[model samples]
Target: MIGRLNHVAIAVPDLNSAMAMYRETLGADVAEPFDQPEHGVTVVFITLPNTKIELIHPLGDDSPINNFLAKNPDGGIHHMCYEVGDIIAARDQLIANGARVLGNGEPKIGAHGKPVLFLHPKDFNGTLIELEQV
Candidate 1:
């Protein structure tokens, strides 16, 4: 089952501008950009009192963010991540409940260095859901 809200991921065409908007304009605490070549994204985390905001940009032409950005040039919310106590158990439960997992239905190392799995957007009311082990 899902736990606390981990973070909300936003796809951005420009990582620098997005980081500045959050850090300088909104007066938020932004972390340095981290490249995730395996995930094909470069991410910047904006920490908050309760949760974090993830700014994601394409790392290469084949990055999934590229497709997302192509769909919406202005970029938008890409996914919402929720914490889970046991990722494998949660995954099995979701599968048993007729939910589809993205990719090969296995957990991958996320930006936080935690095991994470993505669920199909259609299964979650058109919003992509990410389950990260806490």
Candidate 2:
């Protein structure tokens, strides 16, 4: 039902500045940015020892990240992701524990082809949590 942190998603106003800061300033070797049309986000990923970091900016107003950045202009933490052996099982368990699912009742392709889903932030003190199966 639980595992180590997989990645932390961070909302950014500009992808270029965020990439430079994470890659050059923090010295995190990041992969090239990718556009996720499904999520309406363009993201760059930086892998870490225990967890990865995702720098994301909304591609449009309808994008979820747009609303996130609107409320959190400083580009704060957006979501915390944990690795799961089976996303469906984990999701069911989480739901039984009163966690509300945000996306469709199914896993979606995420960064690096990982299966991912979002849990409603309201159920976790305004912290959106993601379950991912590698």
Off by over 4 Å in 1: none
**For each candidate, what TM-score against the reference?**
0.97, 0.91
Candidate 1 residue-wise lDDT, 30-128, digit = tens? 999999999999999899999999999999778988888999999899999999999999999999999999999989999888999999999889999
**Candidate 2 pairs with clashing backbones:** none
Cα lDDT tens digits for candidate 2, 1-134: 76888888888887888888888999998888888888888988888876789888887668987777878887888899988999888988988988899867789998768889888989989899988896
> How close is each model in CA RMSD to the real structure?
0.7, 1.4
The TM-score measured for candidate 2 stands at 0.91
Candidate 2: residue 128 lDDT (0-100): 90
- Clashes within 3 Å, all models in order: 0, 0
Q: Which sections of candidate 2 miss by over 4 Å?
A: none
